[model samples]
Target chain A: MKKILNNPSDFVDESLRGIVLAHSDMLRSVGDPRVIVRSDAPVRGKVAIATGGGYGHLPVFLGYVGQGLADGACVGNVFSSPSADAMLTVTKSIDGGAGVLYLYGNYFGDKMNFDLAAEMARDEGIQVETVRVTDDVASAPAEQMSKRRGVAGVFFVYKIAGACAESGASLEEVKRLAEEVVINVRTMGIGFSPCTIPASGKPTFEIADNEVEIGIGIHGEPGISRQETAPAKELVSQLLAHLTADLDLVPGDEVSILVNGTGSTPLEELYVAYKEAHSWLSQKGIKIFKPFVGEYATSLEMAGFSISVLKLDETMKALLQAPVNTPFIKQL
Target chain B: MKKILNNPSDFVDESLRGIVLAHSDMLRSVGDPRVIVRSDAPVRGKVAIATGGGYGHLPVFLGYVGQGLADGACVGNVFSSPSADAMLTVTKSIDGGAGVLYLYGNYFGDKMNFDLAAEMARDEGIQVETVRVTDDVASAPAEQMSKRRGVAGVFFVYKIAGACAESGASLEEVKRLAEEVVINVRTMGIGFSPCTIPASGKPTFEIADNEVEIGIGIHGEPGISRQETAPAKELVSQLLAHLTADLDLVPGDEVSILVNGTGSTPLEELYVAYKEAHSWLSQKGIKIFKPFVGEYATSLEMAGFSISVLKLDETMKALLQAPVNTPFIKQL
Candidate 1:
């Protein structure tokens, strides 16, 4: 593989060390190096927020640990679940007197690990709540929504939950808010290429030169279809059609938009996709709130992007607009 | 090409339009859509800062325009220079009474286009100055410093100049400080893959599966050499060695570090690089300040990243720390 890595097996540990060193002001290592906590974590009387999954998706689990966002994160190897012990370590470190909330994308390994951690935390006398983000409409049919995978839309849940927790919300309130964010969100992705896992020293999947996979998952999971590549406008329309219809969005509905690049897609290409989404939403009489266009939730070096639409209320808007200062994201 | 684009020839325009539409709160189009300006531009007495180049690099020209950064930017087609007319339009719109500073990476096409724009602006009775960023140590030998190409190190110049201008520095002071930043900064890049320009619909360059090129320019210009891919630690060491030697960095020196991904490179990879850089600098007894790791400047979807070091002083540190809020970056 043409990846810049040290010992393939040590990729996650070394990268975690690098993250702590570079963002010393905002993050620090907890009991385990895989568990990262805010430098000033355990905010008294505040609901502590945490997330984890894999390491390839940077700025997802770790980058969100800062003011007005997640307080701790359990890091795993690239596309692998973090050890439950690592999650418990982070949970113990970040939990204040109030409680702790575990939020992450809906995936089998993540669900099992984080759930195990939650149970362990409870046994340790820490109040724990769990909410999984399931926003990828193409991951499952409408009847099997619970089986859908979470992708870029997870960022919306993190923002809302982090803001709610920062506001001194109770564990129940934070959990409910996170779930609400997940309920109103819909996401879909298109893949132009596959990313290699450093450890495996090969691509997770193979993609053709003249084709694209619509609604692909971050880890190279099959999407709805693989067809000849379409223009940005058509792709955006198709993705949005699936999402808007799935969400039952209607005229005059207001929503926030996020055009998140999987990895290798440039911001320019994302903006092109957003341009078309904006026009489509406008035509539907739907008001677009703070439209975000960038690489938010990414697959390591994957070439493509995802679109997430969150039907927003005044409270959701306020929560998302709250100030945040983190290594990957900053808003003021 | 497997890119999400429509009418390859219209890529830049559509992308720029998308940017403006999504970032309406922070950016707006001037006379020409190719020219994007701060929504609150021409800050009466603040020295206007502007940069322009090909459109592929996001958060470089347009993304940095905001309260304490650039005031406007002239955008061009992918990997191509903005027209003289576009630059003139942006320059006129952002010129506060204090004058305008044209700062951008030193490239033949950008220099000629911006120079022409400066002349036109002067004809219209607006004071303007140009500071070419030449920080890439790999592009040229020490004796041919002027021939060096600017890479990711241009970010240091932008942060310093923007802060200086925000502090109400006089036109000469801003220009002088900007040039000072240029003098102290050094950058080098390693490319694992080439980025395809939309207009061409083909890769700018080609590389073998297991080879990497060091000291590559953002536009896929040739680098020092193509060698078998090395470990992240080794690559970081080689890159830092070139930059530190060129900067004449000593044991007692303090510097700011930027580990920037050139697009396609994941944050995990960047942090891994930073981990090595931190250890190397610490062993040298060099103090690191405000170390940044992420995709700050990119070359579309090119893989690999760049390392930049700016030997810093108290003034430069303070300037870099000043508060700035924009769509892409926010600091407080």
Candidate 2:
């Protein structure tokens, strides 16, 4: 296998061991080894944010469990959703006095698992709310907006909601803020290569040497279209077009941009992509409030990048600029 | 080309433009566009630290320019050293009233360019010092330690030295601390895949699909041997053996470890590597002070990971715990 590891089955557990060993100061595992929470989780008066997802896409689900971010995360095997049992364990561990909000991608499996867990938590007399992020513009049409699958734009949702929760917001208020972010953020990604699942030892998808998939999913699901590989400038322009159209963005609008790299793409390449996106937005008279260029979500060793834009309001702008501290990312 | 870029020849300049666009608050281009300094340079009475090298390695040369890190960095073409003129430009822009230290990797071209820059800056009447980090144990025999090249271990050199400089330490004290870190740190890496330079559009090296290169340099240079890829446990064991022996680390000694991905490798894999390293060290009775697992240094999108251990004394441990804020890395 091209990937590095011990036994394929031990992939997730070994990586968790590494995380526990490296960031013991900020994270801890609970009833289930898969359920990880902040060391100081369950802050007395603050609403808690719990996120869960499959493995492989790091910093997405596990990396977000820290200060100023998600309070807890339950991870499953590579590209597989965690069990409802694990989700319930995390809910019980991170519920502060205020309440707990389940924030995650709009995937069928995750939705099912988290929903089941939330019901169980409610039975336990713990208040719980749910807000699924549907930010990937290509996942669905505008009419079926809720059908959209979340992608890199979940970063903005996490940041805005984390900030609100950290400020001692009520569960209702935090859920509202998170939903608002989900409605405003749109993402479009292009895939040049696919990643292998350690357990399966098989590539998620395939592409010709001269082809690229536009609007590709993180799991390598078929995108909107496949075309000949093109320069970053053209691809970014098309991605922005889809994103701006999806958000109904217009001139004089201010927004924040995140040009994220799928795994295996060099950081320099991501900057190259950002340079093009910045120029495109500038030429259109769109004011960029804050520009983030890095890898927030990845598909193992897949290659390519995504451009996400959040049409920001005054409230969103303040939340976006606030400090964020996590083992995988920090803005201070 | 398997890269997200515009004109390959514009690789460096475009990336620099993107960097300036994204991190304007933390960094700025000096006289030469390639020479970048902190937004607030020359911190009155504090010693200034200037580091520089080629492009492609994000966060290494330029990513370290901010609070609790280097004050300025002059970047060059991909994997190529910055010109003497560019280095001098950075030195002039970031020279605080106290002095400036020229800290960088021990590469032939870089050594020559920075040495010449230091001379020119001295002639201009600004006090200057130099410290070359030679921490890669695989680059040379123990007896020829000074000939070894600097690799990911440079992160420790920057951290401890930057903390010292940030504390208003004198230029002499800062240089001493930097040299001390360079002496105590040792790194070893294994390369699984080669990277392609954008300008050339050619892979740096070639290896059999099933083969791995042990002791590979950051630039894809040949290592001690090429053999069939094995489990993470075996590779990490061999790497730690070289590092602990070269650093003369013994039982009961405290150390900080950085399991660095050489681009392309997934963060999960790096953590898996860290888990093995932690177990190996703990079983040997060695105590771990801090652990960083990520892409601190890279070679474009090369696939590999390096283990860097910095033997820690009380002073070094405290320094390592200090806060660090930069465009790419934050330790707060």
Candidate 3:
């Protein structure tokens, strides 16, 4: 597999090293270089929000750190969770007197490490809370929503929580709002191609050129089934069927829509999908309040996309529209 | 070739349809659906800036149409220029009485069409001036710089022109400053893979899996040559060598850097390249201001990137730092 890299093993750190260098005005490394924090971290009395996961997903954990977003992020090796020690270091670096809130996707490795880090932080007398986002409808049955994997929908949680924390909300309020965001969000993806893990130098999975895996996870996990590639309209319709069913959205319900590219998918294609989504929702009489289309969360060079819908109340809608500035997602 | 589209011929129009629906808050179409303009266009007494070329490069022409960027964009088919009639309609929609400055990449087809559009707009009593960006260093020799093709460096032109227009600079001043930006900019790109033209259902060019094309154009034009794939560091070094020589950047000079990803290149990979560029420039004692590393301009799904350096004087630096808001590129 062809890629732009130095040492495959050093890919994550080198990328982070470059991130800190390229965005020194907004981000910096603290304690450990793997732990990136806002340049102006630990703002007095402001609740600190943090997220962490495996690397390779640009603009996810790290790119989302800035004013009105996460104050800190713990970066891990490609497709591997950060060590608890690394997470603890990041938590300590950004913990203001108020408390720290950890917002991360629901994954076994991440859960184990983040849990241990939370315990260590508690022992050190820093108040901490956690919200594990489980929004991927394809990963579990509707009745077992908590067992679902988190995908691009976690972006909504980050935006809502970051905005709530920036408003000087207490750690509990921010956590509660973030949890609510996770509960109301639903995401489902389809993959046209698999991505290569740097160390492995091979695609995580295989797909025929004219076939696609519907209901695919971000990590290139086996999807619902492999089928002949369909047009953008059909793909969007299929994904929407699962997402809308999971959310049980009623007519007149307002929501924020995110059509996120999985690494290699072009914005042009994402917009094509967005067009169908807009018409689909409108036909159902579902009111779309805000729409975002691009690569927000990704599996490195995966050729596909995920559609995420965050059902919005007045508070959620306001927070979604709130001004937040980050390297990847910025609103003013 | 697999793509997320319906009819191959409908790719551009369907994609534009999606863009208007997804970004309804910021952009809309007027007269011809292919002509996309800001929601608040024709602001009286303010110089309007419009740019367009082919449609495959999503964020290039359309993405830059917003606050502090181009006021309107005339979209065309994939890898092809918009018709002169479409450009004239877009020019008319955003004219605002002050004038309309058409800024776009230098390509034979685009030049012919945009030139014809400028004539049409002038006939209709609209003050129209055109600046075709010639910034891709590989496209022509230094002595024949006027014949160079425009690539990612047009982004610098848009920012400068948009900022100048937002400051209420007259059409002539905006054109002068925009031309100055073109003069100070240089860009070079290498491609790891060829992009497909939708209607053809085949890649526009071919390179062995283990080979790479250096000095490639956005539309898959033949590059300097194809050779064995090189690591990110070496590739950046090779590109920087050519760009620095062309710009004659001296020590202590200030420059804004853009490590732009061609569509499918991952941001993580881009950062890896940016890391090398940062160190390389710092070694030369160049003061980098406003380093941007992402997909600002792209070929539909090309897997590569171009590095752009804009030697910044005080005015250029200030304008580059000015606030701009759009669906793709937003800075505050």
Candidate 4:
């Protein structure tokens, strides 16, 4: 809660300026209320990809805007969606002759704002398509996976769709690939400690000292259930059970796994969880293409991790393997 | 403090396993010890570049190993150097036919270990070279810049040297490029809070509620001095004055600036510092090539920031602009 910020209102604006300055060679900002984008954005014949959300996730919004990822990103305040106007600016800035594709997580505020922006883009006679990633199975029943809330699985959509776009794919192809990734991906999170919002200087959720929550959302949302702290292997098994059960993953299935740490978890513990998870999947005869275990998506300083599995095929594999040069993700 | 690890001793090994599992497509362990290299390392005839250090700094030792950066990295326990055996393993794994180049910071432990490893490699009849990055102006006088401790400036060296290696440069050429980057770069850090080592479960240093320290090293090391908290602009000015005074800066010199947060500092505060720093540098007629503001190199859970300035020439500029695909550094 003791944040070194000047003012809560200026947080997003100031952070954006710094991001632009630091990555000026690779990225730039557009318009007055800046939206981040690659320095060479609006690729003449390629579909422009833009995604945005709240600002607390550093490498997510700004860090992800570089080569082989989003061409532009519109960031909102911490844990809040950007305004419709802000999205509109980003959309316009990255719209090349091939049109633009909007890819983002499926959160309530973000959904509404992106919808409004899409309508505004239509009014401006620019071709625009949208793909809302709803990959967190904890948010909905298995049969209604499309209605689930999005979490870190949105990263997969970004990777796959961005690769398609960077390869000069049409907006329709980029949107389709993004949608496919969203459908094939699933994510579930756990939080051991709650993080304090910088502006409020208060805990976002009440987590008991010795307890951990399974299936927690990234933004301090309530999870499926709470349980006592257990060994690393047991904790990973519990998470994997829920994730695999929700997706009905079977033996010999090929998937890409990600063990993402919520902000405060150390790399040491993350690796422990990954070790158990990798063994568990291997025991099930699952073929993992590339597993990413790090603090990809985080919630302020919360101590926890999330397991995301994206079932991969040849195309998804190639797209994932494509060279991506971004502040956070680097695929060679 | 209160780490989520099972045992302190297993930290590095377990974390390395998790990284390999997570990035199996991109990276793999070099040998039995704590060395990680790109899955497709030892690029035919290019100089193999390697770096290693403590494990607490994620994205620094391991996160920086990918295309356009290090060919391999050895990780030790938190805030400790890897043993010579570990460094030797990495060097052997990444030693292409062209020989190997080791680039790292100027910490005593690291220098001693790397030197021992270099000697061992030489005994094995393998060509080897080393470049110690010592760019912290706060640690040495201008005339003794080579004796200064290395910090975040090592990142610049990794980038430039990695680019040279990728271009099939000889071991000597890569070492020269890395040394040149170190000479042109200078960094100074300040700390507002101390980080707790996971093994100790307590803070590395103590600071009063109203105190901040300037010229702090990344590992919770005691800073040059402590002072009352000041405005972000004032803090940036103080740091810039100390860092830039020793370097020869004319009215219109071009430079690349990095305002790095030491983990706990919020992105918002970093931007405030960047805003003031950018304005001040521009006012001095310094042409900024690209300004980077983010948590690049961090002290675990420490609340502070560091500023690094690298005066640019055509080679430095091109290397900075080169496309790099790494977990942390992404130049597209």
Each prediction's TM-score versus the true structure: 0.98, 0.99, 0.99, 0.89
What value does the lDDT take at residue B206 in candidate 2? 98
True-contact fraction per candidate equals 0.82, 0.70, 0.70, 0.46
TM-score of chain B of each: 0.98, 0.99, 0.98, 0.96
Cα-based lDDT at residue A37, candidate 2: 95
Instruction: For model 1, name the residue pairs that clash.
Output: none
Against the unseen true structure, what C-alpha lDDT does each candidate score? 0.89, 0.91, 0.90, 0.80
Model 4 per-residue lDDT tens digits across residues B196-228: 776777787888877888888888766678888
lDDT of 1 by residue, A80-152 (tens): 8998888999899998889899889999998898888899999999999998989999899988989999889
lDDT tens digits, residues A1-332, model 2? 76679999999999998898899998999967899999998788889999999999988888888778899999999988999999999988899878899999999999999999999999999999999989888889999999999899899988999999998889999999999999899999999999999989889998998899999999998889999988879998999999998888889999999999899999888988888999999999999999988889999999999999999999998988778778898564
Chain B, candidate 3: TM-score: 0.98
Instruction: Please tell me which model should have the higher DockQ, number 2 or number 3.
Output: 2
Cα displacement (angstroms), candidate 1, residue B79, comes to 1.7
Model 3 score (lDDT): 0.90
Computed on C-alphas against the true complex, the DockQ of each candidate is: 0.79, 0.76, 0.74, 0.40
Query: What TM-score would you give candidate 1 relative to the actual structure?
Result: 0.98
Candidate 1, DockQ to 2 decimals? 0.79
DockQ of 2: 0.76
Evaluate residue A2 in candidate 3 and report its C-alpha lDDT on the 0 to 100 scale.
Answer: 72
